[model samples]
Target: MSDNYSIARYLISQLRPGLQLGETVLSPDGKVLLYAGTILTEKHIEKLSYYNCEGVRVRELQSGVGMGFDSNQQRKRGNAEPEELIVSHEYYEADMAATVSEQETEFAGIYGNVVKDLKRCFTIVRLEKHLDCELLQSIVDALLTLSERGIGATALLHTATRSEDYLFHHSVNVGILANIIGNLSGAFKPSQQRNLILAGILHDIGKLEIPVHVLYKKGSLDEDELHMVRQHPAIAFKFFRRFKEIPESVRLGVLQHHERDDGSGYPLQTAGAKNHPIAKVLGIADVYDAMTSKKVYGEEVSPFAALDTIQADSFSGKFSPKYSTPFLHELCQTLIGRYVTLNDGSTGQLVFWNRSGKETCLIRFSDGQVIDIMNQNKLKVIKLVC
Candidate 1:
């Protein structure tokens, strides 16, 4: 094993179950094979070997020691093939090593309860083709109350480590995000805000109509499969049309959530003003959660990365600038004073932003060293440490 700060690179033969990755593992084809924070398993090892992967970088123990293997013994293995090293810039999270805060614990509890409720609600909708409006309303109300208490994207990201079902958790998170965007936009009244949250909750309901195998497929989808997947928005729109209790704006948001302002979106290819305001907010919230939430098929990115992507898209006319601007600004302010781990394996507290460049920020490390992470090519903020 070769050590770089708290990271150790291990050959496939040296990998063992329970070892957590410190960076992403990609295939020769440039597709992500395993994400950072993934605990190694026998299956994962087999997959890595099947792909002819060279090595993986794993987290060192909190005591600054390598986990268990002897580096000399690993090097002496005669049959082991030479591994071509690859550089990774992705952030890593070792929740086991970081200290959890009261807010994280609280969010986890709330997330667990809401996910269970959402699962049950989805099951009922699937069997009866009827949404239990009161039950879903209660769930959204609970999420709104939590939103009122003030929770940030970082808290939501860390709390997701305990969740297993991506769909249910994504639904609840989008609801919360939509509500936050609504509150920040100041364009919606109380009733409309509740409806927008409901819209977010039901935004991906059409995905349930898709086959499980297709919905959770490991890699790329064929053109036919992609076509089927894009039909989700239309399916959801038709289903919601049955209920008069749902507002027209809420239904429109569900249908057009995937419809980008630049006409790059699917289904109807609707552009700019053709999309509903609620849909516009839902679109931003949807992408943000999808990028920041841990999933079975993809890795969750840091909030800073997600914000950067959104800002770029907003500038390119894909997302509405009005909502995206304030949302990004608020999220940056929320990240201040929070703990973060950088690509260099150093943990620090985020102090402030330069407010000039998207990636420029100040981080104060444990040794009282404050870094301007501005033009440092190797230094990147990787993950939020609770």
Candidate 2:
């Protein structure tokens, strides 16, 4: 087989039976569903759809005589010529819009289930004052599985609305975000990554111990109440200490997730190397989720704004650059190709993003005008429409 084929991305909804995969498709758990160069069939398409795969990379052949798929067969099957099979911009946009909607709906269902399970587990632990490691681990495992669904899962984080069950939603979002950061950092093994996610999930579990009135108060907290809220990490640490299933690093991470590199954060005021490695990653996730999530106190911040904050913090010594660099890099890739509504009341597709030097984006408008948003300070992304 010739290695000369190019690869193109296509939404699962746009996939046809005669197309050949340019890359292997894997399940959330890393199980291979199909191999590269495999000629797709009705069964293959059905299987891919069954997995809720967002999209696939298909081979664009010079002449589909190699890779076990013949162009002639595709034509005989009443499919379009291989050269004309490329997904058009309009087609991609239409298909992706549908895909994103379906993904968000599916994600909402999964998220609701996990949050319910987490709330139940929290209730059990709070009443019994006992840590059910297995139960909590099961919830965490479900979250990890959801987080492994690729970029769509990440985008789903923003789709979630702030509800009265803020704690549960926040915890789940942080866990998924932490897992993404860990994977992007390339600094953690699989075991360490799991621990990082576990830490994120349980980081705010201590808040459950705080008085409801104090925790949910809409107004500014008094000094005493603020101090009481700050102690949740320590409180959560004490809870995790009873369980041997929770790794020592996870305990530290939960305990010091608020700790900053500059020693400005709560409870311990641990600085730089004094903070556990996992704690640093958790801190970024925690802050990002808090800022991006809609709040009763304030409107949700745009993700581009959140990224800007992370970038600024990375340079300010509050967030470690090691993890923030890769997190921003990977996250920017996901945000690209998304449609956004600008502050100037214009809607366009984000065609280019350059986070280096200066944070800027190139948006291609419907009138085919490309605008560099950085040149127009008043122009900024206000919302992700799809």
Count residue pairs with overlapping backbones in model 1: 0
| lDDT comparing candidate 1 with the true structure | 0.73
lDDT of each: 0.73, 0.74
RMSD of each: 15.2, 10.9
Displacement of the residue 61 alpha carbon in candidate 1, Å: 26
lDDT of 1 by residue, 127-242 (tens): 88988888888888778765663335435555564336888888888888888887787778887778878998899999999998999888999999999999999999999888
Residue 206 Cα positional deviation in candidate 2, in Å, after optimal superposition:
1.0
> Model 2, 255-284: lDDT tens per residue?
999999999898999999999989999999
Off by over 4 Å in 1: 1-104, 150-154, 161-163, 357-359
Model 2: how far residue 240 lies from native, Å: 2.3
